[model samples]
Target: MTTQTYTPNEEKRVYAGTTMLMIGSCIGASLLALGNRFSNLGWPLSTVYMTLAVIFSFWGYRQIIDACTYTRYSTIRSLLIVTWNKVIAEIVGYATMFLIFGFLVAYCVISSDYIHSIYNFFSKTPACNQPAAYDEGLCNEYIKCVAASNKVDKIIRAIVGGGAFMLLSFVSSVGILSLISSLSLILVVFSISVILGRCIEALIKGKLAHDSGGWTRREPPIPYKPDVWSVLIDFPSYFSLYTLIPTIPSLYAEMKGSISEKTKIIHRTSIYATVVLITIYMLLAYVTSATFYGSNQENYRQDNILNNFSDNDKLVLSVRILYVLVIFTAFVCCLFPCRAILLDIVKADRTTKRGKVLFFVTGIIIVLLLTILAIFVPSITLVFDIITSLFGFVLYLGLPILVGLKIPVLKARREYMEATRAAMHRKDPDTEMKQTNAMEAKIRDRTNSITAFLSVFGPGATERVRQASESIVRRMSMTSDRLSIGGRADRASSSSGRRLSSYRHSHIPFKGVPSTIPEASDLSKIETPPLNNVSLESEHARQQSRLQTIPETYEHDRNRVQEVTEPDTEEEETTHNISTRVVTEQVAIDHSHTISDEVLLEGFTPPKVSLKRQIILWTITSLFIITNSTSFVMTIIKIFSPKGNTGVCPK
Candidate 1:
C-alpha cells in the first residue's frame, strides 16, 4: 500500500493583505445606522467621542499585538490559556459566541432594509408601482407614486439576503475571501465617497440648513453631559461603527515575516483602518445631525440614515446600492473569526471534506437563526448597544489592557530567565555570573513591583476589575516557578518536556526517536525526523548568544546532548521543513496535541475557577440570558410601553 503524500496548507499573506482583511471584516454594516442613534450628542461631540475611540482603539490594537509577540501566543484563546487558565479562555470563548449570535440577530434586522431597498431599486414589483417615477425622494415626490412598503418588504428582503449569505458561505474560502474582502472594501470606499460628496454639496448649498437657526457653526457645539451609564450603552453605537478590533487575534496569526514585521502589519492596519473609519464616521455623523437637528426633528426620526433619504431618488438609491454592496461583503467577512474559533472549539479542521461540511453547516445555521430574528424581533441600535458595551468591553478593551499590565512582569521574568540560562551555559560561568546579577536584580525589582500591584485589590473592585485582577494573578503566579524564560532555545530538553519552556515543550517528543508521520494537521503532537542531531556545542552557542531570526525552531538542550545519525528513507522531507515545522507549530498550538493526547487532554487543570473568572463567566452567561430575557419582556411590554419611540415594534 502506498501512503499518499499531501502538500500542507500554508498561506503567505502580505501586509496589504492584512490591511484588506481587517478593513473588510472590521467595517460593520451597522455603521449606516449610527446617525440617528447619536443625534442627542450632536455631531461635534459625537465626532470627538468616535475620533477618540479611533485613537484609543489604535493604541489598544497595538498593545494586543505586543502582548501576543511577547508571550508568543498565536491565538487569542492560547494567550488566555497561558496567561490565565482554561476557565478564562472558556469565558472569552463564550463572550465571542454570544457576541456573534447577537450580531447575527442585529445584522438580520439591519440587512433586511438594505435588501429591500436593493430589490426595490431593480424590480418593478406591485410594491413599487411606478418604476419610472423614482426621482422623488422618500419625502413624498417619489413616495406618492409608490405603494406603501411594509413587513412583507422586510420578509422578502430577508429571503434574498439569506441567498446572498448562503452564496458567500461556500465561497468564503481562505485565499479567495482575501480577494473578495479587498474588492468589498473598494466598493465601500467608492460608495461612501459618493454619499460624502452629496453631504458636502448639501452643506455648501445651504440645503441642509432648513433655517438660519439650524446652522449652528458660529455657535458653540451642542451642549451635552455624557453620563457613565449612557456612555457605556452608547459604545454599541461606536461598536457598530468599528468592528475590526474584535478580529485582532486572527489578524495577528495571518501576519507574514518576523515578529517585528507582524507588528508593523498590525501598526499599519490600525492606522489605516482607524483613519478611514473615523473619517467616514465623522462625516456620516455630521450629515445625519446637520440634516436633522433639535427636538422637533426628533419627531421625524428614522432608524438609520437611509430612512432619512428618499428611497425613490436616483442619487439616494445609488448610494443605497453601494451600502448593499458593502453590507453583503462585510457580513461575510465578519463570520470568519466567529466561524474559525467555533470550528477549533468543536475540533473540526477546515482542511478536510468533513471539516468543510461542518464549516458550511455552521454558517448556514447562523444565517438561518439571523433570518428568523429579522422576521420576528427586528432589533438594531439596542442590540448593537448590548453587543458592544458588554462583550466588546471584555474582548476589545479589557483583555488588551490586562495584557498590557501583565506584559512588564512577563518581560522581566523572561529577561531574568534568559540571563540566568546564559550564565549557566557560558564557557566561563564565573565571568557570566557577574554579568547576570546586575540584569537579574533589575528584573527582580520590576517583577516585585508588578506582583505587588497584582496582589492588591484595594477598593471599588467591580466584577471586571476583580476578574482581570484574579486572572492576572492566577496566570502569573501559577507560572511563577516556570517563569524561567529562554523559551524554545533556552530550556533543558527533558524527555517529558515538562520544563521545556513550560507548555511549548509539547512540540517535541523523545529527542532521537525515529517515526513515521500521518499528517501535519495536528502540529502540537507530531515530531519530525533528525530529532537527535542537536549537539551540546550548538545548543550552548545558542543559549549564550542571540538566537537566529529565522522562523524555524532553534532547540538547545544545554544540560544534555544526544547525537545519532539516521539512515534516509525512500522518501524524506526536507530538514528545513521538519525543523521549521517544529518552531511554527509551537507558535500555533491549541488545547490538545495529537501525539500527546493522554497528557495533552490533561493539559489544563480543572476549575479552580478564580473569583474573577467566576465573575466574568457568570456575568457573561448572565448577560446573555438577561439581555435576551429583557428583550423578550420589552417586546411584550411594547404593546403597552408608550407607543412610538421605544424602537421595539409598531414603528
Candidate 2:
C-alpha cells in the first residue's frame, strides 16, 4: 500500500480562474427567471435593489471573514467543531450538504431545460419543413388543447421532465458535465458579446430617438402590477442572491492558498471581480428591459427580453452564445461547492475513491428526480425560489452568524473577568500592593486589546496572536524558567483538551482517559456503575458519590478555565502585541487595503456603510420574493379556484 499526499501547485494563476468561476457560479438560470421577478418591483425599486445587492455583497464578505478569522479552522468541519457541539456540528454539516445536493439536482434540471430550449429552437426549421415527419396541424391542435386545459398534459410532462433531469444527472456522474462546462465558457463569452452589442444598439437608438423628437415619455410600464417590479428588481438581485452558493467553493479554494498574503489577495480580487460582473449584468439587464418596455407589446408578454431580441436579430448570435456560456459556467461553479459539502458529510466514513463514486451516484439519482419534477411541474420560477430562499438563507446568513457567536464567547468571558478585576483594584488603596496591581493592570490591558481585536476580526486573528505568543515563549524560555512553567501549562491544557467530546473521541486512540481530557478517567464509568450486589446504603452512597464529585471533577474545572482564558505564552504575548500594532498601523495607512488584505481574506467584507444597505437590500429582496411567490401562488390558486384560468400553452 502507498500513501499519497496531495499538494496544490502554488504557482497556478488563480485570479482569472477564480473570477470566472465566481461569475459563472453566481449567474445561473436565475438571471432569466429574475427578469420576471424584477418586473414586479418596477424599474426604480429594481435599481435600488441592485444597489442594495452591492451593499449586501460587502456585508456577506465581512461575515465570511469574521467566521474565518474567529473560527481559526480553515475547513468548515473545524469551524463547526469549535462553533457547535460535536453532535450538532455533524448534524448541521450533513443537513447543509444535503441542501447543496438538492441545489445541484435543481441546477441539472435547469441546465437540461436550457439545452432543450436551444435544441428545439434550432431544430424548428427542419421540423417545420418536414411535413411528413411533423404534422403542423396536429401540433397546432395539440398546443391549443394544452393551452385550453393544463391538467390533461401535466402528468405526462412531469414524467418526461423527470426523465430528462435524470439523464443529465447520469451524464454529470460520468464527468461529461465538466466537458460541457469548458465548452460553455466559450459560448458564455460569445453570449456576453451579443448582449453588449444589443445593449449598445438599444442605448444608441434611445439617444437618437430622444434627439430626433421621436421619443415620448410614456407612463411607467404597468405601475400597479407587482410582477413588473419583480422582474426588474430580482433580475439585478441575481448578482448577490445567486453568488452565495458559488462563493462557498471559491472561498474554500482561497483558503487553500499557500501563503496567507496570497489568500488575502484572492479574497480582495473576488470582491472587486464580483462588483464588476454585477455592474455588467445590471447594465445589460437595464438595456434589455428598457428596450422591451419601450415597445408597444403587452409588458407581461415581453418575457426573456434578451432572447426575444436574439431571435429576430442575426447579429445576436454572439448573445445567444453568451447565454449558453453563462449556463455552463454557473453549472460548473455550483458543482464545486455542492461536491465540497457532500464530501464534508461523507468523507469520515468513505475513502476518496468511494466518496467520488458515491457523489456521482447520488447526483445521478437527484438529477433524475428533479428532471421528472421539472417535466411535470415546469415552473422554473417556483423551483428557483424554493431552493434559493430556503437554503441560501441558511448557508449564507444563518450559519455564519451562529458560528461567529460561538467562537467569541470564551474570549468575551475573559474580557468580562478582567474588567471586573480592574474595577475591583481601582478602589483598592493599599500602597504596598501598587506594583503588583500595576502588573495585573498591564496584563489585563493586553488581554483586553487582543480580545477586542479578535471580536472584530474573528478567531483566526486570535490564533495568530496565540501562535506569535507561543513562538516568543519558545525563544524566551531559554533564559527564564518563570515563562517556561506558564508556557508548558498553556500547551498541556490547551492542546490536549478543550474541544467537545465528540471531536476528540474519534481522534484519540486511548480508551481509559476521558474524551475531553486525557488526564481524567472515563466519565461514563463513574456516571453509570454496575447494578449487581449493591446494598441500598451502598447504592445510595455511590449515587451520592457520583453526584458530589461530578461538579468538582478535574475535567469540569478544567473546562471552566478553558471557557474563560485561552492559554497564552509570555513570548506569544509580546508577539501578539507587536503584530496587533502592525496590523492596526497598516489599517490606518489605507482603508481599502485593510478591507482587501484583512477582511476579504476571510471570504467576507463589511459593508462600506452601515445597516442602511442591509435594510434596503432585505426590503427589496423580500418584495421580489413576495411578488414572485405571490404570482406562483396565484397560478396555483387559479388552478384550484372555481372557474379560473388553468389552461397551459401548447408545447
Candidate 3:
C-alpha cells in the first residue's frame, strides 16, 4: 500500500513532453468523430483554417498565460475573478468544470462502441467469418443465438474498461498523469502514422478512386469554395483542435523556467501539433471525400471515421485499437482539471494528509459517476456536442479572448504608471511649507532665549531637527562674533583699547562689511541695514560719530548705562557668557537620513492599442461566439431528430 513518487528521471521533459500532453488532450474524439464535417471545408481551405487555428490559439492562449504570469493571478478562475466580477467567476469556473466532466463522460459513453467493435471482430462464429465490415451485424446475430444474450459480454467488457480508467486515475500521482498523457501521445502519433501509411499505400496501388481514371472515378475537388458565408459559419469548428483551455494554465504552472522558455514550449506544441493534425486530417479528408462524398453511402457516415474504413482494410483494425486506447487514456487524465477545480471551489488544502485523501476520493467519485452515466445513457452524442461548444468554445475560448480584449492590460499598465507618477510628483505647498516654517520659527525662538544658568543638555531630535538646531547655533555664533560677547570678550576688550583704530586698520575692508553690532536707534535711519562690515569711510564715520556722541552725565545716560553693562565684573561676565555659548552649542544629531522628494521623470504614458486593432480582435471574437453558439444550438436540435450524418459532397 505504499505510494509511488516520480524521480527526476520520471519527470516529463519541459518542451516535447508538454507538447505531447496537449496533443493527446486535443487530438481525441474530435479527429475521428468529426472527420466528415471537417472534410467539407475542402483540402485547401482546410489547410488555411488549420494554419489559422494554430496561429490564433497560440495568440489567445498566450494572452491567457500573460494575464496569469504578468498579473500574478496564476489560475484561470483567479484571472476571471480579478478581471471580471465575482459572479462571472463562478459562472465560468463552474462552466469549465462541466466541460471537463462532459469530456470524460463522452469518452466513457463512447468506450462502449470501441468495446463492442473489438468484441465483434474477435468473437468466433460462422457469421463472424465474413468481412470485418459486416462483423458488427454478424456478431449481433451470434448474441441472439447464445440463449438470449444481448451483447452481455460486450457491455461487461466496456464496463471493465471504464472501471479500469477510474482505477488508473485514482492510483496516479500528478506526475503520473503527465506520464500517461505522454505515453498516449506516442499512441496518437503511431495511430496517425498507420492512417497516413494506409492512405499512401492506397494511392500508389490505384485502389483509391480518382477522376484521373475519367468522370467515373473520384478526384480531389477544387481547392476553393463556392459559398464563403457557409464556410465562415463552420469556421469556428477549426478550433475543434483546441476544445480544451484549462490545461494551458495548468501546464504552464508545472513548466519550469522563465515565461519565454514556457512560451517556446507552447510554440513548439502548437506548430508541431498543428502540422501533425492537419497532415492526418487532410489525408483522411482527401482520401475519404474522393472515395465516398458523392456515394450513396455518404448519408450513413459513421460517427467514428475509422468505421468508414473498408472491411478488407488492414489498417482499420489497428486504428480502432489506437483510437480506443486514445479515448481511455484521455478520459483518465482529462478528469484531472475537474477534480482540481472542485478542490479549488471548496478551498481544500492538498498539502495535508486529510486533503490528499479527500482529493483521491473525489477523483474516484468523479470517474465512477462518469462511468455510470456512460453505461446507462448508451449515447450522449448530442449532449457532448452542445456542452463542448457552449462550455468549451463560448466560455473557455470566446469569453477569455473577449476579456483579454476588454480588460486592456496595456491600458491598466499606463493608468497605474500615470497615477504613480502624479502621486510621486505631488507638491505640498500647504503642509511642506507649514513644516518648514514651524522648524524655522522653533530655531528663531530658541535663539531669543536669555538664560544665563549653566545649560549643556537638551532633548534629542531627528537629524532634520538637529540640522535646523545646528543652523540656529551657527547664526548665534555669527551674532556673538559681531558683539564680541561670549568667550571672545578678551578680544573685544583688546579691540576697544584701540576701537576706532582697529576699525580703520583693516587691509581687506570691502563696502558694508561691518564687524560690530549697530545700536537700535541707528538701525532706524538705515532701514534695511546690511549684515556685512561697513567699508565706506563716510558711512562708517557717521555711525562712529553717533556712537561717540553718548553722554557721560547720569541723567542723560541712564538708559545707556543699563543697556551697555559691558562685563561689570570681568570674571562674572566671563562665566555667564561661557554658560550661554555652551547651552546654544549643546545639540543632538540623529543618525537617520531622509530621502529627497524630487523625481526625474521622462516620457508620457503610452496610449492604448489603436481603435482599429481593437475592433479587428473584437469582431473576430464576436464571430467565434456567434458561430460556435449557433453550432451548439444545432447539436441540441439533432437530439430529437433520428437522422444519420448527412455527409456533404464536394461542390
lDDT of 1 by residue, 1-651 (tens): 433222223222454566667777766656666665456555556666677567657666776777766666667788777666788787787788767777766665666776676666577433322222223353252244332566565666567447777677676555655555567667667656665665566557744322211232212234244433334345434644656655776677765556666666677767776776676776676666555533434323455665544444566676676666556666776677777777887899899988899898888887777776666554476666666656765666566555555555555544555555554445676776675566445433433322222111111113334454455456555776876433522333342233223333222222232232223365344332121222322432442232232222233342346465553631122233333443443344321222322332233333333467456545644553454445344434543455453211112
lDDT of 3 by residue, 1-651 (tens): 433233355434544566566666677666654445444556667667667876777677667756655454446667676666687778787787887787777676565655555665676322112122335555455345433323553465456545667576676454655555567656767766665565555546645322111112233433234234325444555665674366666776776666656655665675666566666666665655444333334322454555444433445666676667666666656677777788877788778886788788888888777766665553444445666567767564665575576446534653565566677647788986796567545543333221100111111112323444455457557787476445454553354444334333323211222324344466454333112212222333443343223222222544454544555553345433533333333221111122221321234443466688688887887777787777766655555557652323111
lDDT tens readout by residue for model 2, 265-327: 456656866776677666656555554443232212224434344222445533554554554
Off by over 4 Å in 2: 1-21, 70-72, 86-186, 199-225, 228-263, 293-361, 404-651
> Which ranges of candidate 3 are over 4 A from the true structure?
1-25, 40-55, 125-162, 165-174, 206-236, 243-277, 291-294, 298-300, 310-319, 322-326, 343-384, 410-618, 642-651
What lDDT would each prediction earn against the true structure?
A: 0.54, 0.46, 0.54
| Better-scoring candidate (TM-score), 2 or 3 | 3
Q: Which ten residues in a row have the lowest lDDT in candidate 1?
A: 452-461
Best by TM-score: 1
| C-alpha lDDT of candidate 1 relative to the true structure | 0.54
Point out where model 1 deviates above 4 Å: 1-25, 44-48, 51-59, 122-148, 167-174, 206-232, 239-276, 293-300, 340-360, 428-640, 645-651
Scored by lDDT, model 2 comes in at 0.46
Q: How far out, in Å, is residue 397 in model 2?
A: 2.3
